[model samples]
Target: MNDRVNEWTPRTRAVAAGRPSGPGEPLNVPIVPASTFVAGGDFAYAREEGTRTWVALEEAIGALEGGSAITFASGMGAVAAVLDLLPAGAGVAVPTFSYSGTRGLLDHAAKQGRLKVRRIDPSDREGWAAAAGELDLLWLESPTNPTLELIDIASLTGGKARVVVDNTFATPLGQQPLALGADIVVHSATKLIGGHSDLLLGLAVATDETLVAGLRAARTRLGATPGALEAWLALRGLRTLPVRLAEQSRTAALLADRLAGHPAVRRVSYPGQGTMIAFELADADTAEGFCASLSLVVHATSLGGVESLVERRARWAGDAHVPPGLIRFSVGLEDPEDLWRDLNQALG
Candidate 1:
């Protein structure tokens, strides 16, 4: 690792942070597929110690997030690792509406009496502040999934409990949660960090040495290590994250403005940043129709790819609280005018 990397801009750090530092080394870190390395050195088994590929990915992400990072097999794996940091029967506060996967995990834990769960609206600063002292963890999502709601992260930190922010939607380029007073930041690198939707990976970053060690131990004990190829692919995608996010955010803003003025769209939830937007129609049927009617944009479930995707969020039973007419739209690299034209025709 180069000490000079700390001084560069985020964009430059994204591109330059994880490359081989020695003279005449490869420009990109090659995929090291070894499961075990001969005695000594930093690694023995892949699961317990990790490979150079994973190290490269961690270095890049840690540089961008300003913390030590641990990679996982999937986004939920990262989430679970963070949750594992809490003691047994701990009290945790989460967003009332968030990624269904996370909600499902919390529900399962609550059902098993592993933890006490409290659902709080992301915008309720007072509720979060009040609950901060009693809770063991504050799990938050900014520009939340599907709903695209923003939370005041700084306002809720500095309590007795540890604070973890899901930086998946906002991405490191969009915001630095640690700098905003969060103890940890997590990302589903499977989404925007992978850019092309070709890989699945997750990361948890923390400035605290104890928390970082705990997350690494969790990954080892849970066998949640990411594949060598996936880590390499994520690293490649990260190199372009800054540019990709910039273009997508610009187009999202344009579409959001247009959607807000359209009669067919009753409401538009866009935090005025990031590439995600949630727009409401009259009913579930209308929302489904809007998704089905698109030509260029894809009608699908996951988000954050180079191609646009739209889906009726309420279709999932776990997301029943979401508006039946809400469609979560993920803007991509498509020309803004072409995307708007397709959306316009679809709404008709």
Candidate 2:
């Protein structure tokens, strides 16, 4: 990676950081599908060394997050790598409301005697400060999944434990957790980073060399390496992340304000930034009706794609804690008026 590229703005760095800088080199990093290399080279086996494609993706993401990054086969893979850093029966503090996949993983580990898990609300500062002294890891998500709750990351760092922020929702463009004193930042590149929902990939970024090495080792041991093509695709998607997120966030803000005024919406959960919003109706039936009534917005799971998506949060058993009438909406690049029209008619 070029140290000089660090001088550029994040948007500029996003496009320029991972490109082949040498004269006559291809403008983009080509997919290197090799699993083995010739003797005496920097790379030997792909599993341990990684391919050029993965390196480029890591370089760009690391630059954006202000740390060194390691790619994984899936977002859960990255989460698992971070958890692997803990010793057996390690104590962990996590958000009571977070991505279900992450919650499920911690629950499974606790059940198997692999970890001691403590669940706390993301906004509970006192609980976090208390956990900081006793826990091995502090896992947090800001503008948390479905709920859009923000955490004071800087206030929660500098304790006995390592702080890991899941930046999947906020995105690096929205916030750089490392800059705010977080020990490590993780992302489900499958979401906003990939931008198109076409691939599965994850990343863990940290300025701490030891943690970075541990994450890499865990990826190798767990065989959670990302595919070469997926890396290349994510890189392509990343090139436009800044612009895409900006437009989507703008649309989200507009919709959030509009939804707050709608009689059908009891409440709107929007942090005033990012592309996600959650609104509540009268009941589960009303929420389902709103999703089914939409003409333009997709009624589906997953988020941060070019096309809007909406679903009743309580429809999923794992998310039963969320209000039965709550609708998790992922705003896209559609025209603000068009989206509002669709939502208005749906609410009626």
Candidate 3:
């Protein structure tokens, strides 16, 4: 609300991050759905950069990440754009337990000789730092997907490589990667940032203007710009991100604590923050039944939504390293007691 935005808390930033409403203008930003802007103007085409709707969303996310931000059609689109920043023979290192889609993309690029991919254990800070010396890019996903294992991002980013951190699981409210020495911060806005599961969008933020320009050019060439409506929806969800994350995170911790004591649950993995909770059942066989019996929690694939979702992570072919019975639980806005009752019944 004031010139000293950095002095504000994350909740304050989330509620009021975007552009200010001009006098007589709509309180909320209007969606500019035009493919092409007026001739002889600054914005000649939407794909080249973005429209006002997208800019508003970018500014909001950027403000949270403490850098300039760009929106993409999907999370993978943002990932690809970052990868494109590297040269053909560049070496890159990524987490062994990162999001499967990003792993697959890196593997595909490796196969084509576009870049060399090295899968490094996230917990191995020494190995990561060693790789960073030779790598052009180091991609890290803290509290890795499904497993919830965390790495020392500051230590990893101290090396020579350009660091790109995926902060999707730990929303910008939970962790600011840019502040931790990372060169770039990325997020799947479709998840917690959107709060609702209705839209698909991604965001990348960085302090370097040249890198941001390159990412924007890559998005334009690849035609991976986000839709106006999706941008607008994501912006709306972002307005309440702090509130949703607060409730979801509190409920998730409660569920993890209770699940740790359950007989059927072998182990509960929580980073002690964020909305994601992973717990393992007896085996792969019991996982399906457990998921099937949940009355209130929806059995779904994606995480970070308004509704609780439970899914067996090992069912996906890409996540073989994960335990056979691991369930990636995404805590939502539901009451903790109600959620506990559902889990108790489901486990039974």
Best by lDDT: 1
Name the candidate, 2 or 3, with the larger TM-score value: 2
Angstrom error at residue 267, model 3: 0.9
- Candidate 2 similarity to native, TM-score: 0.98
Question: Across residues 1-348, which tens digit of lDDT does each residue of candidate 3 receive?
Answer: 236667778788777767566588677889998999888877888888589899888877887889999999999999999999898989999988889999999999999999999999878888898988988999999989878999888887777799999999999888998999999988999999998999999989999999999999989988899999999999999998888998888999889999999998998999999999999899988999999999999999998999999999888889988789999999999999999999999999
TM-score of each: 0.99, 0.98, 0.97
Runs in model 3 with CA error above 4 Å?
1-4
Off by over 4 Å in 1: none
As a TM-score, model 1 comes out at 0.99
What lDDT score is found at residue 311 in candidate 1?
A: 92
Per-residue lDDT of candidate 2, residues 31-85 (tens digit): 9988999979889899998989999999999988899999999999999999988
Worst 10 residues of 3 by lDDT: 1-10
Q: Across residues 60-158, which tens digit of lDDT does each residue of candidate 1 receive? A: 999999999999999999999998888889999999989999889998999999999999998888889987888989899998888988888888889
Residue pairs clashing in model 1 are none
Return the candidate ranking by lDDT, descending: 1, 2, 3
